[model samples]
Target: MPDITHEEWLRRAESWKVSGAHHIDGADEPGGGATFTVVSPRDGRVLAEVADGGTAEVDAAVAAARRAFDTGPWPRLAPAERGRVLLRIADLLEERREELALTVSLEMGKPVTEAYAIELRAVIGTFRWYGHLADKLTDESPHTPQDALALVTREATGVVGAVVPWNFPLTLAGWKVAPALAAGCTVVLKPSENSPLSALLLGRIATEAGLPPGALNVVAGNGPVAGRALGLHPDVDVLAFTGSTAVGRHFLHYAADSNLKRVWLELGGKSPNIILPDAPDLAKAAATAAWGIFFNQGEMCTAPSRLLVHSSVAEQVTDAIVARADALRVGDPLDPATEMGALVSAGHLGRVLDHVGTGLDEGARLRAGGERTLTGTGGSYLRPTVFDRVAPGMRLSREEIFGPVLSVLTFDDLDEAVALANATEYGLAAGLWTSDLSTAHRVSRALKAGTVWVNCYEEGDLSVPFGGMKQSGNGRDKSVHALEKYTELKTTWIQL
Candidate 1:
């Protein structure tokens, strides 16, 4: 298939002006009172003006979803019927992959090539995977006494409140929506105001793919208003969220106070990449580390922000990492050849720079890329930043900057490395680079993270579960485990 041209992509994006908000009951409803502008991070251009949906809008979407779940045609359809519609949706998504990738890049400032390769591919795969699994997940009867048969069944948690973040909007939305739809649940999705375009377009695509009225909804608004409303809505049976730790906590609180609904959150992280002295190739290790933290402008929740190196190889690894970080190409996200794009926005860029300043104040040495503004750019760009001699308790070490900033710290031994890696309260993910079998096995077992890579960083597969431990929040996002969160398992007993 031919790649989507920049001009064609722009024209298609512009055509989505009327589709930005309140997709409820199979129709678009304009905002009642407030509006917000979605800007392109590449040049601070206004991409579109979206309705800042509030309580009223959220209520309408949720009510629509509830009605669909209770009395609409979506839930009443046979599992095979639902699966057929979802498969059709997958086919439509594949047909427009290039356009969706361009939309993701324009609105979120991700490198276009990376957007196509990473986000779009993953999202399309998610839909196809779940579509196939929908009918296969039907309840089965276990062999037992003739009079007492056990039926193990799974049913959808009605009216899912899916709140996705701006960084990876479509991919995250797919994570929530595909499984929920597969399990026969209707959804009221609230996309982050910063990047609502892709989700809005996805909503339109669902309509074209034969998704019944009210089966899926999208509301574009800020977290304080629309997000809070969805979290607290009584009819919402399950809440699936991906964002910062603070907001995840607030959502949990709201779920408790409002309706005691089931909640699933994939929150923030300060993941560590431990480089041991026995690493096979220092250059490869350094390159993977750079890609792990710097890719997507370090906006991923499970970014490997902390680099724990063995004392013996600290200097060599740090020098290699610095070289790789300096070589990154920073430019406009729309340019197909651009390797690094701007931060999501100027405000987020400023916050990342502020964290760099804090690192300096707390005694971490600014090794490279700490200066802001690439020589010729005016957009929200921050040079890839690296900090050396970072202590465990420093602000840069403890907090998540969510930018192209990396912290380097050294450890004398395996025990020390594991200790340093697990020191943080946030245990989302960790990466270890070592050729020693015992060391890899021991450290991987000891690391307090939900996912660990022995010789790689940020390597994820759809079949494996993805989530976090501790304050990073609970619940898995991918795999069959994710399907469980969207469903409620019921047990039935019979008297013979």
Candidate 2:
């Protein structure tokens, strides 16, 4: 990398901001729109401003998408042709990776290195994966009698409304956009007002990559205004969302209240990280446990916030985890050496602090951290907290606390562990560490989550389907499974 100082990178990020109106149909629209100010959580300074879109902008964007799907060349093109456009988009994103990643860090307060390395890389990979998968989608022909032939195929679901949260803005938006485009659907994406810079830039990149005027559109604003507009838009055939469970329900209501559009959600999680008695390496598991909860400042929906350790090795693992948590460095996100960064906003930081106080009140013993830090500009950073001897009913144990806090609980046997792990209202993702193959298989089946990591945490493969069970929300995000959610099945019968 260049010897780019932190201030220089911050300058680079601010320089890339879009001062124009939202991208509607391959061009910048007029700018009499309401604007949303972007603030840097690292120091509480104004970074940039985005056109705060609402129902009127949403109607225009969705109408553009619907027109592109119904009459434009985008849906009329062959699948491979669409794939080529997506590949071009991937190339453009890869070329401007540093700028996009820096924008995410400035807007959402994650470490720049993580935003670039992990999140942006995944963004490119998702587009590329679906780009390749597009041409491979073929019609299914089932066996039939001599006089009849059955042809089954999938078709696009028209316009998609994608409302993404600030936590993993670009990549989570990728989860919706890639598959929908590959399935030959047009999209109107509403990125969170808190983190709209990258998605707005994406609109220009997609247009530059040879997409049609209305193939992709972006409306940036608060959820109540822009997000609800997408959900309630009659032309929008599907709504894909990634955020809190509290906000996820609003989309369902919008869908029902309007056209009953298909809604795909990847919501919050209070996932379990289990370390069995026969865990291969307790120390290694301990280190991973710390990373599992503390990574991204624990802004991950699939974070293993609830650590369930076998009683035989609970103290050993707990102490090791505490040591690792204490070693984390909380500082400015632009600093490449920093391990943790600030929350996305002051409101989010307050939510996290309130959860910490509730953990103390509910009697979860604070083993490591539970205080605010980096309060010079505003209280945006918190030390990675570890609470031990937590019971089942504690809010920190049962509910989703989307922050860098770990609640450690103990279990005596496999049955008890399964019971405790499956106790939460969420079923997003879970992790287990054990050497025995039988134990791994048995416990994985018993747990009630969409994805389970045996001895690892938050590891993702582009081809694997990702979503959750129960209240963690519906539908898949990656792989061919995601494509299914964006398209509808049709069967054609012909007499020979």
Candidate 3:
């Protein structure tokens, strides 16, 4: 209908203020309830006021979800019926794609183009993927002697509390919520305060799509307030969260202190993007590596913040990467042509710059951009930054700098490359670019991350499992593996 622009986005943002009551038991849409102001990272402007809650709303949401799982018709429905409802939700998401994308852009400060082309598409695809998958789940039967029968059944783990981060809000939330809903588990979703509008809107769209009351809940607030309550609530059977490793650990204690509920965490990463001397195309590898770290302002958990290269080609790759970094367009997020946008908030911008300063002091040479670009619109804009000659022991290479900063490291051999890639405690994802099939196979297996890309970066499919290893956290997010997180297995034996 209308070309994407800041004016049109702001017009809508001003009107969508007052994020309302928690969507518990499927109350008719939302009302005036958002307890906090949602500021647009594009400018220091109040985009909206979203609903906020503490232990009270968390308790109510858990109660509603518990009732839904224990006695509601949702859990009793045929798998096909559940699939149909999820499909309807996917349809509605596409119908409202533009508005949803704009809402995400206004709140999360991602480029509108990426918001529409990448994120919105992925959000819709996830629902449809899980929708179709709903009916595919079946129980297992064990072979037994003639006198007895044994059955292994996977049942809903009951109420789920999902806490999502600001970056990739809806897509990440979908990773947690979709499979859980498909498996018949009710959910209380706590979206990041920095970007709650899309999830809040989803609460309304879901009800319009025929989801039963209490089946899905969206609580908008900070992790300490609403999230702690969700974690500590005895009725919440599972806590599925995607955020920092620090916060993920906090939820563990909440679970231990409460009901010992199951916890599935998709936490932090400093994923490595390695390029061997045999890379088929150094240009392509360099371009892709730059995009991997700078896309979404380098806010991705799997952003490939570290780049390990064979010493033979290290200088060439670094030069190409710096060129790509310097060429990125950084400014207003609402403009469709913008390649990168602001960090999520002013505070986040400070953190990013702080990391850059620390990197400079740690002796990493600044090869490209290393300063914040004031947008003149109060947006938290940062130039795509690159650091060369980064040592493995330096914090610049070790810490997860969740900004548009890339650290270049050199390796003399494949063994050293693999060791450098796996040295980080966080191992959510890794990538390698090479023409050698044997090296690809060998290095892919040696990397201890959950997902490894042989010749690409950040390419994904809903059918694959997404998660981490070691301190990056446990369990998976996408595919059938994710559904397992929301279910409990029970073995039934009967004597005939």
Best by TM-score: 2
Pull out the clashing pairs in model 3.
Answer: 19-34, 25-214, 33-51, 34-50, 34-51, 35-51, 35-52
How many clashes in each candidate?
0, 0, 7
Model 2 C-alpha lDDT per residue in residues 373-463, reported as the tens digit of each score: 8777563889899999899998888878899999999999889999999998899999999999998999899999999999888886987
Candidate 1 lDDT (Cα, whole model)? Answer: 0.87
lDDT (Cα, tens digit) per residue for candidate 1, span 1-496: 3575656555765664434666777777786968898888877778787888999989888888999999998987888888888889889988888778878887888987788888988888898888887787667777878889688788878999999999999889999999999888999999988899899888888988999889999988999989999999999999999999999999989998999999998988999999987888888998899888889998988888999998898898889888888888887776666778989888998899899999988899987898766535556888888999999989999998999999999999888888999999898999999888988888889999999998988787778889999988899988888988888888786757
Error of model 3, residue 71, in angstroms: 1.6
Residue 480 lDDT in candidate 3: 92
Stretch of 10 with least lDDT, candidate 1: 10-19
Give candidate 2 regions above 4 Å deviation: 1-3, 11-16, 30-32
lDDT, ranked from best to worst:
2, 3, 1
lDDT for model 3: 0.88
Question: Model 2 Cα displacement at 444 (Å)?
Answer: 0.6
| lDDT (10s digit) by residue, model 3, range 293-356 | 9999999999989999888998999999898888889978877778999999999999889989
